[model samples]
Target: MIPPRSNRSQPLACNILRYRDLNRIERMFNRLKLFRRIATRYDKMAKSFLGFLHLTAAKLWLPGFVKRG
Candidate 1:
């Protein structure tokens, strides 16, 4: 996977197909469709909504991405 390039208009969006370090892969998850689902969620508390959304995204995505990773 490519590292972030700060000079761009936006941070690079990509999934890490392979990585020597797992932590490095974690940093790239935002480019993934799963984690991005948080944007659509609604909850009584803003923090509650965002936290659960992230958890759901991780639960759904981690299995799929981890397998490919």
Candidate 2:
């Protein structure tokens, strides 16, 4: 076992960049849950369920990459 440091004077620093990324990921999950099928998990098979999930995620992600004509 490693010994703990005795001189703990300052509070721990948070990584702002990592926290921002985590927040973005959490928000994306919240958005995904807005879809009824995904929230209910209607598919019984793992392969089909995963495929549907990928399609749903792509549907959410594609608009950002695609431009409106």
Best by TM-score: 2
Error of 1 at 69 (Å): 15
Off by over 4 Å in 1: 1-42, 66-69
Estimate the lDDT of model 2: 0.83
Over 1-69, each residue of candidate 2 has an lDDT whose tens digit, in order, gives 223345767646666677788889899999989988889999889898889889999999999999899
Kindly list the per-residue Cα lDDT of model 1 for residues 1-69, writing each as its tens digit: 666777878887766555436655575554443443454554668898768766775675677656553
* Strongest candidate by lDDT: 2
What range of 10 consecutive residues in model 2 has the weakest lDDT sum? 1-10
User: What's the true lDDT of residue 40 in model 1?
Assistant: 57
Tell me the lDDT of candidate 1: 0.62
Per-model TM-score on C-alpha atoms:
0.33, 0.76
Off by over 4 Å in 2: 1-12
